[model samples]
Target: MSDGGDEGDDAESDDASAGTTHALRPLRTDLAPVVEAVEATGADAFVAVGDRFDDDLRYLTRFSGPDRPYALVVVPDGASGDDRENGADVGRAVCCAPALFDEQARREFVAGARARGDGEDDDPGDGEDPGDETNAHDGVAREVRTENVGDHAGERAAAAVAELVDGSDTDHTLLVPSSVPHDAAVYLERAGNELSSTDAVTAARARKTDAELDRLRRAQRATAAGMARAETVLADGEAGEDEAGRPVLRWEGAPLTTERLRREVNAALAARGVRDAGNTVIGAGPSAADLHYVGDEPVRPGETVLLDISPRGPDGYYGDMTRTFVVDGDGGWERRAYVAVESARETALAEVEPGVPAKTVHGEAAAELAAYGFDPNAGEGETGFTHGTGHGVGVSLHESPSLTGAGELRPGHVVTVEPGVYGPDVGGVRLEDLVVVTDDGYEILAEYPFGIVPEKRG
Candidate 1:
C-alpha cells in the first residue's frame, strides 16, 4: 500500500515523503460528461449542495471538507457565441464552500487544477493569485472558481448558488441531485429559479478515471492485507475444548471470538492507512448466516467463518472483499457450500465485461448456485443464494452499476463479484473480489487465495 515498496530503514522519512508525494499527485476527475449531462437536462446549471457525506458533491469538487454544508454549481460550456467560436467545449464550475475550509479546498481543488495546467491563463480579476481563496481552478477540463462564505454557511452557500444561476442571462433552471438538502432546494426555488432533480452525477460517478482506479487499487491492497492478518490468526488458532465441552478456536490460549478477529483485521487495515468504515463483518457458525452480522461469538472449529471487509482509504475510496474459512473441517456442509460459492463467483466474474447487462452477472451467479443444488430464490429465513452478486464500490462503498440492477457494465466500472450461500444449520460460504470492467473484459484489483482452509502469511 505504500506505493509498492518496502518502507526501508527510515520509516519516518518514508511516511513524510508519502504525504508530500500524495499531495503532488491529485486525483483527476473529468467534468465534461457532467457538463454535457447538465446540458441534456435542459437546465442552465447543475447545483449540488451537501456536506462531505454527500458522495455526489464530493465526486464533483473532490473537496473533503467538514460536515458543514457546501455547494457546487456547474454550467455547461459555450454559453456565449464568442466562447463557442473560441472552441471552449468544457463546462465551468464554482465551489461555494465555508470560509473555514478555504485552504483545504484550495489544496484539493485549485492545486490539482494548477498541476494539470487547466487554469494557467485564467485571470482571477481580483489581483489575487489563481490559487487564492477567492478563485481556484479545477483540474478537470472546466475552470472551477471557489467562493468562500462565512456565518450561516449553509444559507449563504445556497445564496451563492442562486447567484450563479441568476447571473446567467439566458439560463435559469437549476438541476440538482435528488439527495440535495431540502433547505437548499427550497432556497433555490424561492430565489425564482426552477429546480429539477437529475441522476447525471450518479451516472457520471459510476465510471471512474485512471486516478480513481489507482486509489481503489491501493485501498483494496490494504483490504487484502487486513484479510491476510485475519486469515493468519485463524491459521494459527489451536483447536481446544470449550467450557461446554464443545470445540472452539483458541489463539494464544484465549478463545478466538469474532470480535477479537475483527480487531486484528482492523488493526492491519489501519496499519496500511485505511479505515474499516464500520463494514468489517466477521461471523462464525450460525452467525455467518446473518449476512451483515457484527456480533461477537465463539469461532468453533470445523464451522464456517465468513470475513467480509470493506474499508475506506485516505482518498475516500472503498475496498471490499470477502472470504470464508473453516478450521479442521470434516468435509461436510461447509466444504460443499464453499465449492458452490466459488463456482458461482467465477460465473459472476466472467460476465463482467463492458456492455453486459449488470443483471446478467447476477443471474449467472444465481444459476450456478442453482446448478449446485442450492435454491437461488430462497426466501427470508431460508438457506441458499440469498443476495445479489455484487455492487459497485467507490466514494460510497456501494454506488452505481449494481450487478442486480438493469444498468449495463462499462469500462472503468469498479464492482465487487461476491457469490454467497447461507444456511443457519450449517453456516455461510462466500467468495468476493474487487474487479473493474475493462475495455475487453475485466481486471481483478487484488489477488487472494480461495479455499476453505485459511492461509497464513509471513
Candidate 2:
C-alpha cells in the first residue's frame, strides 16, 4: 500500500455562466507544447472539434455544453501579413463556437488568459513600447480569438477553418485529434485541408500540469469518501436470508441488491458534487468473475463484491478507483484473493515513475500475481488475471500512456495500478488507486485505506 499523505489543497474556480460550471481552477493549457507537437508532425495547424464531451477540446479550450458547438484552430503568430515568414514556435489559438455560448466562452477565455504574477490592471503603458512582454506568445488567453458561427456549428467551423488555411502562407494541412467526430473531419477534408492523427496532442495530454494534478487529487478525495460510504454500508450489513432461504447481506433490514449498492454509491458521490460517468461497477459472486459486469443479483455474505467507480468531478476531471470486499467478513478464498490483488497492486505502483515503460509496470504486477499462485496469462476462456494492468486517467477516464506495460511513463502522468484475479469458482478480487507520476517517484492521490473489510462505525 502507498502512503496516504496530504498532496495539497483542493482546486476550485468560478464558472463562466455556461451550460456547465467548473469548480476547479481554469485549465492552464500552454499552446507552446501543442504547437511543438503539431510542428513536429509537419502540420501548419491543429484543429479540435466537438464540445466539452471531447476531452481534448475541453482541455485546450474548456468549451463544454450539452450541445457540441465549437471548433478550435492553432496557428503560429506573425506580423500582419507575413506570419509564415516569422516562423515563430509559439502558437495563436482561435476558438470558433456557436453565438449562443459566445459571451460565456469570451468570459472564460479572458479569465484564463490572465498572466501569472501580474495584476489585472498591469499594463505596458503605450502600444509602441514593445517592453511589455506579458502579451507575448506564451500567454495563451491573450493570443486566443473566439468567433461565433451563427447556426451551423460544424459547417461554419469548416468554413472558418477553410479561411484560416487559405489565409496562411504555410501548409494548409491541419492535424485533427482522434477525438474529433467523423463528420467534423469530413468537413475539414472537404474544405481542402488534409487531416492526420493528433498523436502528439495525445502525448502532450498524458503529462498533467500542477493545476491539473490538483484537480485530480481533489476528485480522488471525493471518490475515497464515496468508497468509505460503501464500506460503512458493507460493515453495517447484517447476515440474512433471501426468498429461497439462501444466505445474503442486508443493510438497514433490506436485502442489498447490486442495483441498490450502485444507487447508494452514486448517491454518495453525488453528495460530494460528483457526477457518475456511468462506469460504476458493483458486481458480486459469479458476475464478478466477468470484467465490466453490471451485477444484478442480491449480494450475499461470504461473497466478494467488486466496486469500481469513475466519477467526473465538477471541474471535468475524472477519479477512477476500485475495491473488492466480502460482506460480513468472510475469511475464505475471497480474502486470499484480495491479499494477492493488493500485493500485485503495490508491486505495479512501485514501478511507476518518469522514463519507465508503461508495459514494464504491468509486467511487474502480472509477475506478482503469478508468484501468488494465480495465472497472470490465462487463455481467452480461462479465468485468471484478466484485463490490462491499468490506464491513464484525466479529463477522460482512460487517456494515454496506457499501462499495458508499453508506453513511456512521464512526470505529470496520472494512472491507476489496478490488478485483479477473477475465476468462476472463487469470484474475483480487484483493487485500484489513482496516482500521479513524479520526476523521481509516484504519489498516490486516492487517500483511503486498502482493507478488504470495513470497520464498524461508532
Candidate 3:
C-alpha cells in the first residue's frame, strides 16, 4: 500500500475539477514501441475507430469525445515525403474527430503532446510562433495532428486512413485492431485499403506508465472510500424485523438491502469524483453466490454480502475491489470460506513479480484453495473456487495479461488479485485487491482491511 503523504493528500483533495486534476502528470505514451510492433506486421498504416466506449481508441488518442465515432491513424514517419524532409523516426499520429469535438480533441491530444515537448521543438507555440503548429516527432508520435471531419465519423476516419497511405506506390495494407467495427473495416476495404488485424495496442496497454499508475492509485483509494461507506452502514446497523416479522439488519429506520447498500456505495464514489459505471455488485444471502448479482434482497444479521465495486475515475481509469462482510455473525461456513479466499488472495499476490508467468499466479491461488478443502475444479454448478484468480485492469475494466493468460508479468502491469469461493449454502466470499507489478515485487494500490465483520470508519 502507498505510504500516506503527498500522494495520499492529492487523492483526498476534491478541489480539482474532473479531467484536469489527473493531468498533473504528463502521459508517457511513447509510440516508439508501437511503431516497432507495427513495422513487424508490414502494414503501411494503422487505424482504429470507435466512440467513447472504445478504451483502446481513447488510449491511442487521449481524446474523450462524445458518443460518436472518432478515428486515430498512425503511419511510418517517413512514409510521406513531408515527414522524410522533417527527419523523424517515430511515426505520425492523426486524430480524426467530429467537428463538434475538434477543439476538445486538440486540447487533449495535441496540446498535451506539445506540453511534453514530444514534438521536434520544445517551444509551446505562442500565437505568433510558426513552429507552434508543427508535429510532435519525438515521443508519443512523430507528429500529432487533428482534423475536424464532418458528421460521418467512420467514413471520415476511413478517408483519413486512405489519404495517410496514399503515397505508397504499392497496395497499402492498413493494420486495424481486432475489435474494429465492421462498418469501419468495410469502409477501409472499399477505399482500396487492405485490412489486417493486430494486437499491438492491446499489448501496449498491458504495461502502464507512471502517470497511469498514479491515476490508478487515486481510483483505488476512492473505491476504498465507497467500500468504507457500505461497511460503515453495516457496522452501524441494528437488528430489526422485516414486514413479515423476519429478522433483518436495519439502518436509518429501514431494512438494509443490496439495492440500498449499492446506492450508498455509489454515492460515496461520486462524492470522491468517480462514477460507479453501474458496476457496483452487492449481493446478500443466496444472491451472493450468483456473481454479478444486482438485485434487492434483504441483508440479514449472519449472511455473507459480497461487495464488488469497480468504479471508473474522471480520468477514465478503473478501480476494482471486492470485500465480503457479515454483520453480527454466527461464524459458520462463511468464516471458513473467507479464510480460504483471503489466503488464496495472498498466495496469488505473492507470485506477482516481473518475469513470473501470469498463469502461475492463478495456479498457486487454486492450489491454496484446494489445500483448504475447497476444490478449484469443482463442477460447473457446485460450490468452491469458481473464477480465475484475476485479470488486468486499466482503461477497460478487463484488459490483457490476464491471470490465466499465457503471458508473463511485467513491471508496469497493473492487475487485480482476486480469489473467491461461492456456495449457495452460505452465500459467497471474495477478497480482491488492485496491485501493480514492480521491479522486484508488487505494490497494493491502497490499504483496506479484510474481515467478515464490518468495521466502522471515522
Candidate 4:
C-alpha cells in the first residue's frame, strides 16, 4: 500500500493550525435509574427507538460515518443501557435510513419484538417458550427503533414501529419519543394500552468519556481558527452585491458570493486538518436579525455582518460562537445595536455557572436590554435588538442544561451566551461565545477577536 506516508515528497499540509484532539469531557453513565425503572416493569429487553437524533443514535452505536440508509440499533439486556462500561456489545447492530417507527408507543411495540428476538431464546431450545405472551418481568427483553405514522417528519418513524410491533402483550412496554410530533402522538394513542416517553437521552450522552472530550476540544480549536480567518476577510472589505441590485464590492479574487465565503470557510478549516464542520452564516444588516440567516446575499459596503460559526467536535460534540463586524464604514444605528449586543453578551457569559437557574441567566440578559432602553418582555426592539439570550450547545447544537426561560442551568452543561440587535438600513451586531458550566463560574471556549470595525482598505 504505497509504502506509508512517503517521506521525501512531504507536501506542505500547512493545516497544522487546524487543532487536534477533542473536548468530550466524560460519558455520564447515569442511565441506570432509567434502566432500573424499565427493568422494574418486568421487561426483559429494553428497546431503544429514536427520532433522527444524532446523540440518540450514538447512545448505542458510536456511529462515525454519515452514509447509512436504514440503520436500526439492537442491543441485548445485561448489555448496554443496563450496565455501564462493560456489559458486552452483545447486541445486533445496523445503520440504515429507512428506520422503523412513526411514533413512540409503536416504537415501544417494536422494542418488545426486537428484545424478544434478541434474547436467549435465540438458542430455540433454551427453555424459553416463544408463544407465552403474558409475562412482563418474566422474560420480556426490551428493544428500540424508530417509527412514524403521519406525513410529518416523525410520521414514518411512528408508522415503522406500528407496523412491526402491533398487538404485543401489555407486559411488553414500548417506548415512544417524547419529542414526537403532535400529529404522530395522536396516532400513537392506539397502542391498545397506555404508553410513555423518556426524557432526552443526551443526558446519557453528554458527560463524555475521556475520548469524547478530546474530539470536542479539537473542534473548538478549529472553530477559533476559522473565526480568525473570517475576521481577516471582513477586515479586508470583501464585497459583491446588495439587495437593492447595486454592485458595490471588491473580492479577494473573483466575485464574492455568500456561497463562496461559506465554501472558503469550510475549506480553510479542512486545510487546517479538522473534519470540515460545515457552513457559516455571513449575515449582512437585516439578515442578521433572522437569527439563522444563511449567507445568501453578497457583502455590500457599510453593512453590519454577524459571523456565527458552529463546528461539531469529532464524535459530534458541538461548539457554537459568534461575533459581529462592519463590512464597510457603518452608520449610527449599527454602532448602538452592536454595542448593546456586545454588552449583553458579556453579562450573559458572566452569569453562567453550576447552580444558577437557566431562567435567571436569561433574565440577566434582559436586564441589560432594559438598561439599553428596550423592554425585557417587550420582545424585539424597534431599533434592532431581537431574540433570546442563548441556548445549550453540546452533543446536539441545542440540548439540555439550557438557558431558556424555562430551563434550569446545571453543572456540566455548555451553552451559548449571545445577544444582538439589527437595523435594516444599517446592519446588525451580535457577540456570542460558548461557555461551559463550571464548579464556580463558566469557561469561555472562544478566543476574542479585535472588536468590530468599519471597512478598511486592504
RMSD, every candidate, angstroms: 5.4, 5.7, 4.2, 10.6
Q: Per-residue lDDT for 455 in model 1? A: 65
Give the distance in Å from residue 197's predicted Cα in candidate 4 to where it truly belongs: 0.9
User: Which residue pairs show backbone clashes in model 3?
Assistant: 119-136, 136-142, 137-142
Please write out the lDDT profile of model 3 over residues 58-89, one tens digit for every residue: 88777776587877777765544466456544
Model 4 residue 201 CA deviation (Å) reads 1.7
Ranked by TM-score, the better of candidates 1 and 2 is: 1
**lDDT of every predicted structure (CA atoms):** 0.76, 0.71, 0.78, 0.52
Residue range 1-458, candidate 4, lDDT tens digits = 11111131111222235443322333322234344544455433223433435456544433333332223322224445444343333322222233332233222222223323454333222344322222322233333333322243233333434343442333324443354345445434442324456553545544444444455555665676666666666666555655566865556665455566566566756755555455477776567665677757666666666777787655567757677776555456677666676677767766776667787777788788778865456445344456767776666777665566564566566677777666555566777766666567766554455466733211
Clash count for each candidate, listed in order shown: 0, 4, 3, 74
Q: Report the number of the highest-lDDT candidate.
A: 3
Question: What is the lDDT for 65 in model 1?
Answer: 71
lDDT of 1 by residue, 215-251 (tens): 8877787788788889999999999988888889999
lDDT of 1: 0.76
The better candidate by lDDT, 1 or 2, is 1
Two-way lDDT contest, 3 vs 4, winner: 3
TM-score sort, best first: 3, 1, 2, 4
Q: How far out, in Å, is residue 369 in model 3?
A: 0.6
